[model samples]
Target: MAALRSREASGVPLAWLIEAVTAGFVDADVSTLLDEREERTARAALPPSFFGWLAAEARVAQAIVSDQNEGDSRVPYREVERAAARMLLEFAYRLMHDDPDRHFLDLPFRFAAPAARLGIESSLVIQAVRVTERRWVDQLLTAAGERAGDIAHSVLSASAAIYDAVVDSFVTDYVVAQAQLDGEMLATKRALIDALLKPGVRDAKGFDDLGIDLSGHHVAVVLWHPTAGIGPHLDTAARQIGMSAFANAVTVVPGDDRTLWIWLTFADDPPPAVLERVRSIPRDPGRVGVAIGPVARGVQGFRRSHLLAREYAAVAGRLPPGIAPDIADTERMSYLSLLLRDPERAEWFVATELGALATGAVSDRENRETLRLYLETGQSLADTAERLRIHRNTVVYRLKRIEQAIGRPIASRRHELYAAALLAHLLEQSES
Candidate 1:
């Protein structure tokens, strides 16, 4: 890049190039130079005929960027054309003046802003500047006939310097513009994600624009590291899990430090223990926290899975050390998880709903335990008694006491209630 800018022939001073760059730029009149060069070489490079052609044919340059903007739905053809025309004219002027930063306030010279706005990546825009400049040089050379050969070397040198300088400026501006757009886009995506977390908050057109789809089966995983950056690690984990488990995955940061919310999408329920693949990555130091939600379908399922994944993290926090489970099969402890989700609220509900049995009385505990066992054993007195190591009459007596304590006859409808209560008790037991 520096070599291109350093190329200067006789009559063109290198110091002037640096000075021109330092002092800003002035638009160069190229047709006037062509007229002078033509006087020396007795050529007609800037003939009346060529000027007439440029008046009409310069519009062709506008289509160049459109060809480069592949698969971009937001291609702004009119703005791109306006910018390209200006860029071509800017190139023509730079060829004469040797001022790289000439036409500073013009739309043609400000190519990078339009490129970035039209969904062009910075790297690609830099390449576009290089390619477009070379093409412009080619057209200029063809336009300037062989009779102008005396000054062709000088013209090429000036063009190369212009090309290098224009490319450098375009690249710098493109990167800065891209960063600003990317920041704005990131904030927009974050807002959309927050909105998408709610039920019935999706817009198909909006999601399509952002390329986010929740209308699929999703298994969500929550991961966090106490120390170290997490995006790269989570990215590695997502890739590993997706490849090994044969599912496509999307990740969301959810604005937590070193935490990642990953959702793996599948045609059906995801494979069992899918996160084990994430845990198996070579970088796995076992320092990262992981919790997984069960597979479910559609938008509701996607939101529910994330909610459950977060809920699993909550449950894990309350669990004892050295037993930080890898998977949080929300399906397994779902009944209990409902209680564990908010211990205080569950406790209040239990106390109010279960009355005396919710108190920790020995006989009440015995009756509640026997009733939980009886229901779990399919109302089998023998099975409940054997599990409790007491006679069938003892099971019957406990059932009567449970019915009285709860102020309701023990029936199929009451099973869900008692099961939730039993799960709460069992979760409490883990604390001991």
Candidate 2:
């Protein structure tokens, strides 16, 4: 990139090129290339906001060249893309004026840092630049006519130099900014995560810098692989989850080589169907496990959601690789999560409350599930029978057996039995 800059510095100054292109040399009749009629035609061909239109076209072209449209549904210009396009347009117009910025080639530098922060690859910027250059060349050719050869030699040379300088600036800035992020931003994010986990730790400016809106609803998620390097898969999974939930924005923080903590922000809580879609990520390749927290609102929601996800992760992490659910969520696991917080006490409680019903025998498993459903359905035997697809008498028989194993009537300790049954089920799942 520096080589490109050095090469440009050694060539005809950009201001001189601009003077020659617009004012024309004494020998070349290039000034008359775009006569009044041709100018009107050119103006008619483009809308009033030609630069804006060109910027949008460049965005599309960049997306195609970057292969961002293949399976990804995100808009190409979602990042600091508009800024990049503006920089490109500014560069072109500056080339037509005599007083180009002393740091004209560094125009891309202003937007590059922000683009890099947004994870925009340098290649995409180069693609946009190439698109803008091509369009400019087409316009130049249309106006060239008989002076085509002279215009091509002079104007094309200047445009190529400008293109090279801008490309170098973007490439250079992205490299520096990304490197800085890898070192500094990682620590900053970790600090931010730590602060967010604690109560009453709010940094408005810091949250703004990281693009997190504390006022919006948030769903926290943790993705991990017990024995594999998460690598880029974590980011890809985060994107899939965000898109599925129709999140307005996503923020991901790498917790370690094997884990990523993510937050998806939305204007309001997504419907149940969207959450189901988020949970379906296990079907995708990579053997990644997702633990999602319930949707909550405001700063409290952000903190609560993340805390719940971490709790869910603790339980989900107990499952053997490939045995973890695609999505382990607080909605389904919060009760068990509380029980499992102290594994030893939880085990003793399960054993004592469930008695012989906690045994691994198939009969006991059936009895335990029947009792659990009986309690969950508001102690309605009919509802339990319907769910288990058994006759009401069968549910009655199971209840009797469950009571016999526990040495008490089911109604004597319904809530205790319910909690123990849930913990027993979780323990069974872990063992399996």
**Which of the numbered candidates is closest to the native, going by highest TM-score?**
1
Residue 29, candidate 1: C-alpha displacement in angstroms:
14
Candidate 1 local distance difference test against the native? 0.60
CA lDDT of every candidate: 0.60, 0.68
Question: Could you give the C-alpha RMSD of every candidate to the true structure, in order shown?
Answer: 10.2, 13.7
TM-scores vs. true structure, each candidate: 0.56, 0.55
The TM-score of candidate 2 is: 0.55
Which TM-score value belongs to model 1?
0.56
The local distance difference test score of model 2 is 0.68
